[model samples]
Target: MARDLRFEPHDQPAGGWGSVRSLFRHATNAHSWSRAVPVLPKQNKPGGFMCVSCAWAKPAEPHSFEFCENGAKATFWELTTDRVETGFFADHTVSDLLGWSDHALEAEGRLTRPMRYHAPTDTYVVVSWKEAFDDIGARLKAFEPDRVVFYASGRASLETSYMYQLFARLYGTNNLPDSSNMCHETTSKALPESIGVPVGTVRLDEFDATDCILSFGQNVGSNAPRMLHPLQRAAERGVPIVVFNPLRERGWETFINPQAPGEMITREPTDLASQYHQVRAGGDIAVLMGMCKVLVDRDDEAREAGAPRVLDVDFIQEHTHGFEDFISRVRASRWDEIERASGLSRQAIEAAATTYLNARRVIAIYGMGLTQHRRGVDSIQMLINLLLLRGNIGRHGAGILPVRGHSNVQGQRTVGIADEPHLVPLDRLAAQYHFEPPRNKGLNTVEACEGIIAGTVDAFIGLGGNFVRAIPDRARMEPAWRRLKLAVHVATKLNRSHLITAETTYVLPCLGRLEVDEQATGPQIVTMEDSTACIHASRGVAPPAGPHLLSEPKIVAELAKATLPSNSRVPWDDWVADYGRIRDAIEETFPEDFKDMNRRMGTPGGFPRPLAARERRWNTDTGRANFKCPSSLNASFDADDDPAVMRLLTLRSNDQFNTTVYGYDDRFRGIHGSRMVLMMNADDIIRLGLTRGGMATLTTVADDGVSRRMDGFTIVEYNIPHGCCGAYYPECNALIPLSHYAEGSKTPAAKSVPVRVSAQP
Candidate 1:
C-alpha cells in the first residue's frame, strides 16, 4: 500500500470543545475577526441576516449564541477578507484553473468584478454589466426559450428566486431547476401525494413535545448542527431516538452543547440515539415498511382479541386512502427479504415498532440518505407509510421532517423554481405581470444534463450555485456543460461551475447574504422559508464585498430589463427598487400561501406559510392522504452478479456543506488532511482482500458501456453496514450515472451506487 490512512476514531461527544475549537479555527481561516466579528450576533436573530448554510429552523426564543459551529463556518467563509479581481482571472486560464480543487478555488475568496470569458486567451476579462447584459440578451434571443435553462441554488432568497423565475417564465421557458431538485425533491414528490403537502407539517415548538424520534439516513451533527439542541433535549427526556443508517455516525452517539455553561464546565455529553440500527444502503424502504408491517400485525391482533387497536383507525379511515390494499401487500411481503435488505432481524423491527406504539407523538426525520437512491421516491413514501400506521402526520410533535441543506432551498422551490409547468402558478404569474406565460414542461437537473448532452439545451443561466459541480455524472456534465452557447452565473464567489465556461460565459459578481444591499429604495430585506414552513426576513449587516457588486434581485432585474425589451407591465426596476412590492405581488398571486406576507415579514419571527397537512386538510386530487406500496420490498440494486459489488453512498465532510468544501479535515469522523478516503466495514475490507490503509479504486457497476471509475482512494475501516461503503460527494459523483435516478422524482441516486472496489492499479 502506497498510502497509509489514519484510523483514529473520535471518542468525544459531538458539539463540545471540539465544536468550539473548530469554530475559532474556521474563523481564523476566514479572517473572521476583520469582518465576521460584528455580524456574529446578528445572524439568525431578528432584523439580521440568515446563515447561508443548512435550513434548520431558528427557534422562536434563540440562545445567546444562535448559530452552530458549521453555521459560523459558513458565515465566516462568506465574510472572508480575501477578494478576487480581474488580474487574478487574467493570470489563470480556464484549463489552468480546472486543475485546482473545489476548496482551493473557493479559498481564493470572493469575486470582485463581473467577468466574461475571452475564448481566444482562454481567460476571463473584466466586462461592464451593461455590455455583458446586452450581449448575453442578444445571444439568448437567438435560441428557443426551451433551449435555455435557468438554474438556482438555495442561497437565493424568496424575492430573488421569485424575480428570477418570473424573468424566465416571461422569457418563455419553464426550465427553472434549483438545488432542491437534487437534494430533497423526493420529499416534495412523496409528501405531496402521500400527505397532500410538499413540506413536513411539524412546527419548531411542536418538536419539543415529541416523545420519540426516528431518524433515517440523516446525520444531525454535520448537516444541521443546530438540530442537535432539540435532539439532545429529547434524549435527556428519555425519548427513544432510533436511527436507521448505513454507518454508525458520530452525531447519533452523543452531543455536548457548547453554549451550555454546565456542559462546557462538566464536560458531560448527552447520549443520543437510544437504538441505532445499521441498515444497509437503499434499505430504508424495507426497514420502514417492516415497521409498518409490525404495526399492522399488532393492530389485527388487538382487534381479534377485542382489545384497544394499535393503529389510529379513525384517522386512517377519515384522512387517508389505500390502507386496506397497502396492509395486505405488506403482510404478503417476505420476512427473509426484509431482513436481507435491511440487515436487521425481525425482532429488531418489532422492537422499534414497540417503541413507536408506546409513544404518543413521533417525528420521523431523514435527509439525502433516503432520497438519493433509485427507489428514493418509494423510500420516502414508505416513510410516510410507517408514520400513517400510527397517525404520525398532522399532529403536534409528530410529522415527517426532510431536513434540508442550504438556507433557502425550499424557499426557492416555493417561489416557483420548478421544471414542471403545473407545479408553478404560471397563470397567476402572467396575470400579475400582464403577459401570457408558457405552459410547457421544462427540464430538471437530470433532464437539463440530458438536454446539454443531447445538444438540445444551448444556454444556461445559473443563480447562486455551482450547478455543474453539484449534480451527478460530473464526467459527462463538465464536458457537456462547457459546450453551451451561452452560460451566465450570478454569484458572490468563484466556483468550479464558472470555470467550466461555455462558448460565451460570464460570471456576474453579486452581494453575499451578509452584505448590505443598497438600492434605489435604500436597504432591502429578503425573506427565506425554512424547513418548518416559517418565512422570515434576513437583513444584511456587513458592507458589500466590492463596490461593483449588485444584489441578486438587481442582477435578475437588470437581466430581465435587457433581455425583454423594457416592458412597462413587468416593471423590473420598480420591484428591485422596493422589495416590499415583490412581497405584495407574491401575496396577490398566492393569496392562500402568503395571506399577509408583507405584514408578517416585519413581525418578530415572521410567520408560517400555510401547509394543508398542518391543519389536517388534504390538498390532493382526491382530497385525502394516500398510502403507497413499492413494486417490491427489495429496494437495492441487484449486486449478485459480482461478489465485490457494494452499495456506495456519498458523504459530506464535517467542514463542508454540499459542494462547498470548507476544509479537507472532516473533524467529526477523525479524518485529517484528506477527503478522498473511503469508509467501509471491517469485514468487507477482509472479504475484498483489502488491508487497512490500502489504496482502492472504485468503478461503477452499471450496465452502461461507459466505465466510470475513480482511483487512489485510501481505505479506512469503519462501522458501516456489510456490503456498503462511503466516499465524499462531487468527487465521487463521477461513479453515479446520470441515467440512475429515483423512479418518480428523478433525484440522483447518490446514496446507493453499486460499485466494485479493488486494489488501486
Candidate 2:
C-alpha cells in the first residue's frame, strides 16, 4: 500500500482537546484502553512503573493522570493485545515485510517467540530458546574477542546495561556502541569539560521558582509534553520564556494544560514564549556569541555610567578560571559576523540579552537540535558560558538542563556504559567481579559502523533500539550490517533492522517495560534514571505480553552464561533470579552513587545521585570550572558561498518519538497521512520555483563524490527561517554521511545537512 500524503494549516494550541482525543484513540486502537483503566493510574506514582517513552522527569506527587499523550501511546503500544505469533510469521515473509512502512511493521504486533531468518525462503521461522542461545554462543566463540560489537539502547534499564557492559569487558572487549553516541554524545563530552560533571545541574522542582527560561533546539510541547506544565505555569506567572529554533514550533507558542479542568473546557491555551527567534541551522554558536557580546558591551557601559555591573564578578572570581580570556573573546566578536552567522539582527539579540540580564534566577534548556550538529560540543559549552555569566549554577531555580531523548539514556551512562574504558573506574569493577576489564578504548557508534564495513567486526548484538534505521547513512550501513557473521536483537516488536538480516540472524523476544518478569525469586523490579539523574524503582503492573518472553537482565545474563568461560565468577544465574542482587552488585561497583541504592529505591521520589556541579564543587583537571574558548564560529561542514544552497534539518513530528511512528498524522504541524514532506519557508518555496504540494528531490551537497537523494517529497510552506528547510528523520537520514560529525564527539551531524532542493521529474 502506498502512503498517502496530505497537508493543511494547523493553528490550534498544542495539547488541548486534540491530545485528549489522541490518547483515547491510540489506547483503543492498541486494545489497551480498558487495560489502561487499571494501569494508567499506576504510572509514575510511588513504587509504580514509569512511562517507557521519553525520559521526562516526573513530579514528586503524581496526578490522577500522570502520563502525557505520547506516554499513553507508548504504554498502549507496548501492552497491545495483538501478538506476532508463529501463525503471524507464517503469513508474512521478510521480503514482504521489508516493503511495509515502519509504522506498518510495528503495527503487526509484538513477537511472542524467538525467531531465526532462513535465507533461502527469506522468511523468519520460530526457533526454540536453546537453539538460539547455542547458535549465538557458537558464533561468538568462533570470532576474535574484539570482533564483536555489543550495542545498547537508552531504553535498557540500569541493571540490564551494567550486566551487558560487564559481560563485554569480561569477554575481553569494550566495543560498546550505544544510542547515546548518536544523540547526546556532545552533552556527555562537553559538560564535563565545562562544569566538571557530565550531567545537568537543575532538579525537577526548580522550574517552579524560575524567573526566566531559555529553550534552545527543543520542541518541548511535542517531545516532552510534561514540560509543558512548567512552561505553562511560567507563562501564567508572567515569567519571560525565550525559544530559539529554526522553525516556529506550535508547542512553544501556546499550550493548553490538559490537567486543568477550566482550560480544557474553555479551550483557552496559555501563551508560552515571550520571544521566539528562528535561528538558522548550525547557528547556535553565533547566537551565543551574540548574546555574550551584548552582555559584555552592556557591562562596560554600566561601568562607565556608574551603574551595577551585569556580569557576576563574585561568582566568576570565586569558583571559575579563564574568565578574562572568555570576556575578551566575547568582546572581540563583531556584531556583523554574529548577525550574518546567527541569521538574527543585533537588535533582536540585544532584546534577548535584556531578558537574560533582568532575570537573576534563570534556567537554560536545550535538546538534540543543538547537539546533533558538527558544532554540537561548542554549542553546549556556549550555553554553559551564558549561564555562568549570571552565576546560575548552584542557585535556586537557575541551572543548565540538557533534555535527553531516551528514558534511561543518562542512567545507562551513569551505570558504566561507555566506549571509553577509562570513563569508569575499572579497578572497582575488576575487584568486585574478579576479572580485569579491557584497558583500551572501544569503538563508538561511527567507529563500530566502520568496523562492520571493514569486516573487522564479526558479530553484532543489540540490547534495544532499531540500530540500522536509527543510525545515519542507512544506504551504506545497511549493506555493511548485513555482512556480519551473526546478528541478534533482544526486542519486543518488529522493526526494519530485523528484516535486514545477517548470515546468522536471531530475534529474541524480550519483555517490555510494562510487563511482568517472573524469576525463581518471584516477580522483579528494575531501576531507571531520569534526565535529572534521579534513580527510581520501576515495577511493571501489567501482565506479560507473551509467556515465553524474558526480562532484559535475564536475557543479558543468559547470553553471558552461554558465551563466557565456565569458571567465570560473575554469578550470572544468581543475579538473574533476583534483581536486588544486581543492585547490590551495582552498589558494590559504584559505592558512592549507589551506597544504599536498594534502601533508597524505597524512597517516595527515589534518590538523586551525587552531582558535583550542583554543589559548585569543581571536579575538572584544574579543580575549578573552566570556560572553553573556541576560535571560530564557522561550522565544520564545507559550505559554498552559493545562496542557492539551503541547510536541511531532520526533525521529529508531533506524532513521533525518535523513529517510533505512532501514527501518520502530525496534529501540531497540520500534517496528515504523510512522512515524506518538506517544510519550507514561503519565500524559499517561491525562490526555488516550487508551489505548495509540488514534488521535489533533496540532493546532498557533499564533496564525497557520492550522491544521496530523497525523492517524491511534497513541499509545504511553513513559518520557518529562510534558507532552511525541515524534513522527518529515517527518511532524510540517507542524505547524512557518517563522516559529518562533531570532531571529537563523533556524533552524526543530523540537524544541519547542506542540500539543494529541485523539482522532481
Candidate 3:
C-alpha cells in the first residue's frame, strides 16, 4: 500500500508572501524557479502586446505594471532563454522525444528553425524554409481541400486567424476546426439558438451596477484572475455574490488583490462570495430548473391575485417568444424531483430564488464546468430562462457571461473558424474572392480525431495548440496521430502534440504575441476579440526570441503562397505584408454593422464588436429573442445507472491552465506536492466502506467496456456532495469516455462521468 501522505495546514493570513509562497509550492510542483532577467524595452509606445493568458479586456486605465501571474508565466514561456535549434533535433529521435513529458520537452527551450521527421532515421532533420514550403505545397496540391484539416488555437492573433480561414476557404475547404471546440462551443451553439447572439450580454462595467452576481462552476481567480478586481468591487458595493460548484474554491470565497498597495502591504483580503453552495456535479440543470419553477409559481400566484406579476411580462411579450410554453414546462417540473436531482434542500433553492427576485440586476457567469455535461446546452438555456424572467439580457448589470478559456478562441470564431453545416462562410468567400469554395461541412475537433483514426485524414496542420493532449481518449488519439501521413505544427514551443509524430512531421516555430514581427510591409498590428466581443489591436513590444521564429500571419501567408496557384486571387503576399489589408478583407467578407475594423481596433480601450444585445435587437428569423424548453428533464443524468457507479467530476488545479501543468500543487484545496489524490465526502467513503488514503481504481460504466483503470489514486475525504467524486482534469480525462458527450454540443461530459470506484489491490 502507498503511504498515507498528510499535508500540514498553514494559518498564514491571506495576501501575505507566506500564503503566496505556500500556494506556489503546492501549485507549481515545488519546482525551483530562476527569476526572469527583465528586459527593458528600448521603445515604450503603446504597442499591441495582449495578455496571452485570459480573455480579460485590456482596461483603459494605464498602470506601471499590469500583468497577472498566469499572464507573466505565459510571457516568460514565450520569451524563454532556451533555444531548440536544428542541432538539438539531430541528437534526439522522434521516439526519444515521445518518451519525455510535455513539460520536459518544452522546457528544453524554443524551437528556432523548421525541422522535418525523416522516417528512415526515426529522427527530425533540419529543413530550409524554402524546401519546407515546397514540401507542404506539394502535399496540399495532392488532395482536395476538404481532406485537409486547418486547426487553430486561441493564442493565434485575430490578424493571423482571419488570414488562415481566408487561405483555407480560398483553397476550397471549410475544414476549419479550432480550440473553441474544447471549451465554449456550447455557449456558441446554445446562445445563438436561444438569444440570436453568440456572446456575453453584459459589459465589464455592468458589474458595478449589479445587485446580485451568481457564478456557476466558474473559478474566476485562477482562470481569469483580472476578473477578481471587478468581483471585489461588486463585493465592496454590498452586492451579494453567490457561487455554486461541486467543490469549495477559496478564490471565490475571499480574494486579496495583489495589485493594491494597501492590501499587499497589510495582507488584508475582501470577502467575495456571500453564499457558497456545493451542488452535486451535473446537477446544475436541475438546480436551475428549480429556480425557474419557483419563479413561475410565484408569478402565477401573483397573476391570480390583483398584484403585479413577479416575472417581467412586458419584456417577455415585447422581445421574447414561446414564454407561455416555457412557463408551462417550468410549472410542470416537480420540486421533489428537482431537490432529489440537485441534492439541495427546498429552503436553499427558495433562498437562492429570493435573492434573484429581490435584486434589480443580476449577472450569471459560468465556465466549462457547466458546459462539460450531457445536458450542457439545456443547462445554459435554463440559465437564460431565469435571467429572461427579469429582462436581464440588455440591462446594465445583468446578463450571462460564459467565461471562455483561451486568449483568442473567441477571435478565431469571429474570423470564421466554424463547422456550421448550414452557414459555412464559404459562400461569402466565393462572393468576395470570386472563387467557389467547398460547400461540404467540415469536421470539428472530435470529427478530426475520428478521421485520423479511420485513416481518412492523411495530413494535419495545426496553426497553434497541443491537440493530442487537449482531446479525450488520448490512448486512441496518440495512436491515430502516428497513423497520419503528414502532421505539421506551427507553434511557439514543444508540447505533447509534437511528440505524437506522424510518418513525416514538421515543427515550425512561430513568433509569440509579445514579440515583434518584421515583414516586407514593415511591423504589423494584430487584433483580438475579448470575451465581451470587444476587438482591440495588439502590438509586439519585444524583439522575436529567434531569427527563425515567424509570425502566425506571415507563416499562413507564406504557406498559402507556396500551396495555392499563382492565378488564385487571394493576395497572400499582400495580406502578410500588411495586416490592415487582411482586416479590410475581413470587413469586406463579413459586412456587419461595424466594418471599419482597422480604425476601430486602433482606438484606446478598444471597441465592442457589433452585437444585437447592445441594442436589444434580436437577429432571429422572428426578429425577437426565443425561449427554449429542454427536450427532456432528466437529460444530464444517466437513465439507467449501475447502483455501484458514482459520477466523477474533473477539475483543474489552481496553478494549471487547461492541459498546461505549471506545477503539481493546488494551494486553494490545501493540496501539495501531488495531484494523485481524489476529493470525496466523508459520508461517501463510509457508505462505500472505503478508508482514507485508500487507493482506488475508477472504471467508467460504458457500454463499450472502455473503462479506465487509474491505480494508486489516494482518496481524501472532503466537503463534496455524497454522490459525486472530484479529481483533477487531464489526469482524470481517461475516466471520461468520448462517446459519452453532450448530444447537441458534443462537449465531453468531463464534469459527470458515471464510474465505479473500489480499493486498488
Candidate 4:
C-alpha cells in the first residue's frame, strides 16, 4: 500500500512591513544572526567557488555581503549545526526517510561521515572510508566501464570536472552525461550551429550600449536577481525592454533590489518592462518567425525601390550561409498562419518588429521556457536567426543570452562532461593516462534511470545533485533506484537522493563551496565558468562545520585510487592534494587561454574564458557565423487531437531555486500555504464551467494509459494565457511522460505537457 503523506501549511505575514519586522528581529537576536551567517575566516580575499544558486555573473566585487537570499540559504543549509551522523542513520531506516518531504529531509541537516546501507538490518550502518572505497571499487571493477555511468552536477569545479572526465576516459566510458543535458542542451546544440559558439555573446557592460532588450521566457528578478540592476539601469536610460512569457511573472513587470538600502527602506521599486505580452505556451517560435518574416518583407520593399535593405545585407552575404533557403521559407509563409499560431495579431508583431528595427543594438535573452518544448532546438535556431537578420552575432550589445540555471553548469560542459557522439575526451585521456578508454556510448540521465529499471545498471554513483526526485516519471524512477547493487552519493546534506538505497548504499559527506577545504598543500582554490563564458576562481573563507567532511575533489580522488589498477597513469593523489596540478593537466589536454591559470585567476576580477566576444571573431567553418533557417513556423499544439486536454507548464516558485524549496510561499506570485494549486486563466476556468478554488483531476492523454490524476488540487484563477495552465515542478513531474521530450535536445518537455482538467469525483 502507498504510504500516506501530509503537509502542514505555513502562513506568511503581509509584505514589506513583515519583512522589516523579520529583519529587525533577526539582527537584534545574536544567536539567530550568528547561526544564520556561516562562520568564516577573517580574510578579505574572495573565494573560488561561484554561488551555486543562480547564473548572475559579476566580477568579484568587494561588498559587506556578497551573497543573495537563496545563496545564503544554500550556504546555511550546507554549514548547518545539525549533523546526520552514524548514530542518526543507524536509528532511521531508508524506507522511513523516503516518506519525508524534500524540504524536511534537507532540513534534517548535513551528513558528517561515510555510511553504507545494510539490507539485512534494513538500516544504514556507518562504514570506514577504506572499507567503503574497497567495496565500491570491487563492484565497479565487476562491470564493463561503458555500463558504469558517472554523473556530475553544476556545482562541481573546473579542476574536479577535468579530473572526473580524465578518470572516466581512462576507465573506458564516454558516458559523461551531466545536468546540462537536461537544461541548456538546446542552447548548446543550436547556438553553436548558428553562431559558431555555444555561449551567450553579450556582457553586462554591453547593456549600456543596447537600445532594446527582447526577453523571452526568462524571469530575471526571481531567477537571477543581480541581472535586474543592469535592466533597471537600461530602463532608466530610456531603453525599451520587451517581455514575452506565457504567464505574467511579477519580476518581469516590476522589481525591488534588496541590495539597495534606500529602495529597500522606502519600499520603492523599479519598473522593468515597457511592453509585456502573454504569448501562448510553446508559441514563441511562431512569434519569432512572424517578426522575422515582417523584417524580411520590409527589407524587400526597400530594396525594390532602389533603397538599401532594412537588414544588413552585406553582413548576411559575407558571414552567413543558407540565406536563400531561409528567405524562400519566410516568403512562402503566410502572415495569417503566423498570427493564428502565435496568438499575436499582425499589428502587434509589426510593432514588435519595428522596435527591433529602430534599435541600434538589441539583446535577446531567453531561459528554459524556450528550450523545454518538443521542438526546442528549432525554437533556439529561430531566435538566432532573428539576431542574425541584423549584424548582431559579433557585436557588443547585440547577441543571444541563454539564461542558465545552475551557476557552474556551463563550466561542466566546457571541461568535457558530454555524451557527444564525436569529440570524446578519451582520446586525449589514452595519451595522458596511458590507458585504453571506453569507446562505447553511455546513458544520459533519462537513460540511466531506464538502465536501472531494466536491471542492466547495478551500481549508481552521483557526485552531487537530487537525481531521483529531479527527473521526470517519479513514480517509475523511485522504484528503479531501489534495485541497485550499490548506490553512492557524494553530498553536502540529506536530500531525497540519499534515501534511495540499494542492497549496499553509501552517503559520503563532502564540504560545500562556502566551507574551507583543508588539503595536504593547505587551502585549495576551485574554478567555475559563468553563463557569459567567464572562468573565475572561488575560495572558501568559512571553516567546515565538521572535520570528518571531505571536499568533492578529495572524495572522487580516493574513489578513483581504490578503483583503478596500479598501472593507471592518472595521478589521483597529486590532483586532489594541489588543484593547480589538475589545472595543468587540463591545460595540457585541452589547451585554451588559461595557460598560467593560477596566476591569471589570482588577479582581482577573475579572467574571461576563450570566447569570440573578446576578439570579435566567428569560429564557424566559413570563417564567419552561419545563420540557419527554422524547420517550421507552427508553434501551437493540436488541441483537437485531444479535445479534453489542457496544456500544462511546470514552473519554479519565487521562494525556491531549482529543485530546492526554501519555503512553501511564493510571495511575488501571491501564492501562499500550498504548492499543489494550478494557475489558470479566469475566462478559461469559467468557460470550462469550473469555479475558482474547485478541486479538479488532471489526466495525461497518452496511449500508455498512465494517468497521474490528482483530484484534490485547487484550481486558481490567474492572468495566464487562455489555453495555458501552470504548476510547480518536481511536484508536477509525475504528469510528464518520459517519452514526451524535445526532439534534438532530448530534454524533458517540462514546459509543455497536455493535460485534461475535470471536476473532482
Candidate 5:
C-alpha cells in the first residue's frame, strides 16, 4: 500500500528532481536499493535489454540514462527480490488470493515454479514441467481448435510472438488475439486504408527537422515520460507544439529536464505545448474536421485574394484520390455543430489551424485518446485526412506518429499476432513451416470474451498478460472465465487472472525481461519492434529468479512440441536451442519486412523495417492516398441524449502502466493512497448535486441488457469539459460494458464510457 493516500495540487513541472526522487524511492522498493542499481545504466542500451514499458523509439545515440520514471518502476517491479514460491501458494488458497489488490498481489514478487490447481484443495500445487506440458497438450487435443483462445500481451518478444502465432496456426486455429486489439488496432485499420501503411511514417531523427508537432489524447507524462525530453528539446528549439485533450496534462504544460544541470540549478522549466486545447472526449473527429474546415476556408480566401494556396494543390492532385468529395464534406460541416460537438469555440479551432498552416514540416501524433471511441477508426481517418491535405505523409520531417504502449506491441502485430488473416502472411508461413495455416478470421478480444461468456470457448492459453482483468465488464467476464475446462497462463508474477481458476488450470512460470536466458546455444538475445517500426535486439542482464524458470522461447517450444503429433512440421527443439533459427525462419517468411534480419541484428541502433508509405508509395486498392469523412463528427456524443449521463473516461496513474498498478499515488494528478476517485468539473459536480471529496456511485448507461456499477468513488474537482468525468482505469473499468467499443476495430471504448454519477448511500 502507498505510505499515504491524499490529494493535493502538484505545482512543480514534470521530470525534474521530482522524477529523480520518485525513482530513488521506487528503486528502494525493488526489494532494496542495491537490487535495482546495477541494471539502471544498462536499460535501453545496445547490448542490454529493452525497457518493458512504452514502445517509444530508442534514439540512435541514447543518453547516459535512457530510462524514464515509468521505465524505472517497471524495472524495479520486474527485478524485485521478493519471490512467490510453492510455499507461498500452499499457504494461500485461490479464494483467499482473490481478495488481494492488484498491487499487493504483484508486490509478493516473481513466480518461481510451475503450479497446477488442485480442485478439492482450492489451491495451487507444484507441478513438473513435463507433466504440465503433457496435460495441456492432451486437453487441447481433446477440444476443437475453435473452442480455444490464444491471447498474447504487448510485452512478448517478436520471436516468441511469431512462435506463439505459428503454434496456434499449426494447431488448426487462427484465434490469435493480442493486446493490440484493445489499443492501436484502430491505427492498424485506419492508416493502411488511408495512406496504404499500417504503421507510423516518422523516424526518431525527424524530430530535429520537424518545425511543428500536433498531439492528441496522449498523457505523455504518465504513459511515456521519456517523450518529454524530445518535447522539451523541441520547445527549446522554438518549435511550436500543439495539443488537444480533454484534460490539461502536465507533460503538455511544462517540463524540467532532469539531465540538464542548467535547468536543475536555475529551477526553470520549458513550456511544452504552445497551444493546449482541452477538447471534449469522443470529439477528436469533430476537432480534426474543424481544423480541416479552417484550412479549406483559408484556401478559399487565398484563391480569392490571389496569394499563396493554403493547401498543397499539386500534391493532392497527383498523390491523392477523393479530394473533391472530402473537401465538400468538410465544407458542408457547420461551425455550430463542430463547436457544440467538440466543446470548443470556432475561433479556437481556427487558431489551431493557423498553427498547422504556419509550419512547413509537421508531425501529427496521438495515443489511445483518439482511439477507444465509438468512431475510433473514423477519428483516426479524419486525422489522416487533415495530414493528407497538407501532404504531411512521406514529407521531410513530417508524418503521423501513434504512441503505442508495451515495448513490442507493434512488433507483435508485425510478427503475426493478429485476428485478421490477411494481415498475416499465410502462404509464406505455410511454405516456411511446411504446414497449412488457418485461413478463417479469428475472434478478437471482445469477441473472445463474448465466446467465453457463451461457453463457446472451452480453453484459453495466454502467453502473457492478465486477460480476465484487462477486459471490460469484469463482473460478467470473471464467472465465464471459470467455466472454461482448461486455463493456462504463461506469466512472471501472480495476478488476479491466475486466481480465477478453471476446472483444469496450469500456471507456467517464465523468465522475466532482462533475466539471463541460457539455451542450447549460449545466452539468447531476443528482438523487439518499437512504435516507429525499428527492430532491435535485447539480451538478458539479470540472473534468473529460480532454476525452474524457463525462457519464453523454451516454454513456447516445449508446449508446441507437446501439443503436435510425433511428426510435426516445426523443428521446435532446434528453434528453442537457438533463437537465431527462428529469426532465419522469420526472414524467409517476411523476406521484405525483415530482410537479412539475422545479419543486421548487430547494428548500432538496429535497422528499420521497410515502409512503403514513408516514400509515398500507395498500397491501397485505388493506388493513391484515399480520404474518408464520417457522416457525423461526434463519436458517442449523441450515444445517449439523457441529460443525467456524463461521459466517463478512464485513465492510468503516473505510478501505473497498462493493467499493472505499481503504486496508489498518481504523481502528475496529485492523488495518492487510492485509485477510487472520479474527477469532474466543478460546475458539473454542482449540477449533479455532488460535493467535492464526497463519495458517489457510477452506473453505465449502456444499451446492453446488463448493468455495470462502480461504487463509492471519491469526487474531485477537475478542469475537464462539462458533462465529462475522469477516473482511474482497471478500477473504473467496471463501469464500461463489453458491448460499448469502437465499431470496426472492436477496441474497448474505455476512454468514452457513458455513465451517471450520484450520491452514494
Candidate 6:
C-alpha cells in the first residue's frame, strides 16, 4: 500500500478553486455524488441536519448552500452508498485489515448490521442487536461499577451524551470520560476558575460588532471552514484580525468565499489577518504575558498623564479580584525574557498590544494550539488576563471564544458527559431517576487508559469516537483495550477502533446525523449546543443507510434496560421512544441551563444558554472574576538550550477532521497522498542534516527511562519557527507520553513534544 507522495506549493487562499475541486472529488469518491449532493443544502438549515464536522454555530438565516467543503464531505461520507456487508468482513480478516490505511478501512463503507468479533477466525461475524445488548448486560452485571469505563465522542448529540452519563451513573460508576478530556478539557477547567464559566461567553452574532479579533495558536481556516465567513466579514468591515501561530496557514492570511459569485469566477480571496506573528510552539504564555506587560505599562503612562484610564479601572474594582498581583507579575517580567521565550521582538508584541488597547470591542479566539501544552492552563489564564484587564468580557461584541473542534463536544459537556461526578448536581439526578449517583470522581481519557494498562479496568464502552486512535501512547493503550473483559462501540462506520477487540466485542451500528432516526413513536430530532452556546435541534431528512441501524438513544436505552433491573426507576423505554423525554430528564438535571429545552429547540434559531460571565455575575470561589497569576512568566521550553531536539506539534490536516481521515491530501499545506509526513523548519532540517522528502525517525524525550519511537516519517521543509516541527495527529500521537500533560488539567501535551529526529536507520 505504498503511496506516491506529492507536494505542490499552493499560493491561492483557502476555500477558493481548490476547495471546490476537493469537495466534488471527495463527494464523488464517497459514491454517487448526485444522490448525496442534495443533503448539503439541508445541512444547518432550520430544523435540518447539523454538520458532523466542527461545531461552528449554524447561521441564523439558512443559506442555499449551508455547508463548507469538509462539512459536505462529512455528509457524503456518512450518506455513502458503499455498505460493509457480511461479505466484506469475510473477505478481509482483522489481521489483514489492520495493515490497510485508515482511509482504505473506512472507504470500505458504512457498517450494515451489528457485528461480533470471532477471534478464532479473526473476522467479524454478524449478530443480533438484542443478543449484543444481552451480552453487554451480562458482562456489566458480572463486574464492579468502578471497573467499567464509559467513553463519549464529540460527534454524539446532547441526548445521547446525557443518556450515556445516566446509564453509567445508574450502573453505579461515575467513570464517564469523553473527547473533551483530550482537547479542550483545559479550557473547561481553567475558564471557570478565571471567569466563572466553563464555555466561551460570546454570542454568534458578536463577530459583527467586534472591532478587533486576536487569534492565538489555531489554524482557523483548516479546522473550521465556516468560521472563515465571519472572519472574512470582519476583515471586510475594517476589523483588525491579529493572528499568532507557529505556521503560516493560508486561512490566517487570506480566504476566498466560495459563496461569492464574482470571487469564485475571478478567484479573488480576501485578506484575513492585518498582522500575523509566528509565535513558537509552547511560547503562548510568553507571548500573552508580553502583551499584558505592554498593556500595564501603557496604563501606568495614561495615569501619569491624567488621560483616560487604560486598564478598565471601574470594571476591575467592581467585577474582578487579584488584578494587582497579576499586574505585578506582568510588570516584573523582563522584555529580554519575553522576547527570547516568545520568539517575537518586543516591538511586534507592543504593536499588537497597542491595537488591543485602542479597540473598544475585542474577541480573543484560541484552539488546541493553546490547550495542548505542558502549561496549557497557564496559557489559557494569561489570555483571559488580557481580556479581563481591558474589561472585554460581559460587554457587547467582546469576550473570549474557544474554537471547539467537534460538532457537539461542548454540548456533551453541557449535558453531563464528564469525568467529574459533581459536574451535574447528583442530588437532582438521584431525585429524578430514583437512584443514588456516584459521588467520587472517575477516570478521564488518560486515566482510563492507565487503568486499563494497570489491569484495573474490566469493561470498556465507547459512545461514538475512535478512542484508541484519538488517545496518546497507542502502543500501550491498544494492548490494554485487548485485555478488557468486554468492549462495546456504538458506531455508524468501520474504523480502527473496531479492529482492536477485547475478549467480548460488539459493534452496534447506529444512525448518523444525516440519516433519519425512526423510533417507536416516530422520527426523532436531537439537539446540540454549538461553540457559541446556542442550542438547536438537528433533524435528519434522508433515509437510513441500512434499516437495521438504530439511533444512538435507542442503542443506549436498550443497553440500559438489558443491564438494569426491572425496578430501576429511570424511564429508559419511554425516553428511547421519544427524544423529548430525554430532554425532560436533562431539564430536571440542569434546570438553570436547559429549562424548556423542547420549546427552545422548536424556535427558528435555538435559544442561547445563560452565561454568568456575560452578565458579570462571577461564580468563582471569590465571587469575582479571579486573576490567576502564574509563578513564572517564562516559556515551557528553552529554544537556545535544545538545538538537537525540535518541539513536535500534532495537528489535523485540512482534509481531515479529528481522527477521521477524509483523504490523504492536505491541499492548503501542499501535502498529498500521504499522512506519514512531518513539516519541519528549513533551518532545523539543514541543522539535522536532513533533506526534503527524506525519511526520519522520531524518538520521544522523557524522564520515565523508557524510550518510545515512531519510525519512517517523511520530512518536508516548511515555513515554521526555528527549532519547531509539525506532524499530523493519530500518527504522531504515539510519540506523546501519557504523563507529559498540563499541570492542572491532565490533557496530553500533543502540541509540544520534545523529540529528536534522525535519519531512518
TM-scores, one per candidate: 0.98, 0.98, 0.94, 0.93, 0.99, 0.98
Per-residue accuracy of model 4 over 399-518 as CA lDDT, tens digit each:
888998887888877777777735455566678777776676677777777787788877777878887778888777778778777788888878888777776788888888767777
Better model by lDDT: candidate 5 vs candidate 6: 5
The list of candidate 1 runs beyond 4 A from truth reads 1-5
Which candidate order results from sorting by lDDT in descending order? 5, 6, 1, 2, 3, 4
Give the TM-score (vs. native) of candidate 3. Answer: 0.94
Q: Give the winner by lDDT.
A: 5
For model 6, the stretches where C-alpha displacement exceeds 4 angstroms are 1-3, 32-34, 634-640
TM-score of 6: 0.98
Task: Give the Å error, residue 444, model 1.
Answer: 0.5
Q: Which stretches of candidate 5 lie over 4 Å from their true place?
A: 1-4, 567-569
Give the Å shift of residue 607 in candidate 3. 0.8
Per-residue lDDT of 116-184 in model 3, one digit per residue for the tens?
Answer: 878788877878888888899888888767778889878788778888887787777778888887778
TM-score, model 5 to reference: 0.99
Give the range where candidate 4 is weakest over 10 consecutive residues by summed lDDT: 1-10
Listed per model in order, the count of residue pairs whose N, CA or C atoms clash below 3 Å is: 0, 0, 6, 9, 1, 0
lDDT of model 2, residue 196: 90
lDDT of 5 by residue, 281-354 (tens): 99888899999999999999999999999999998998999999999899899999899889999999999999
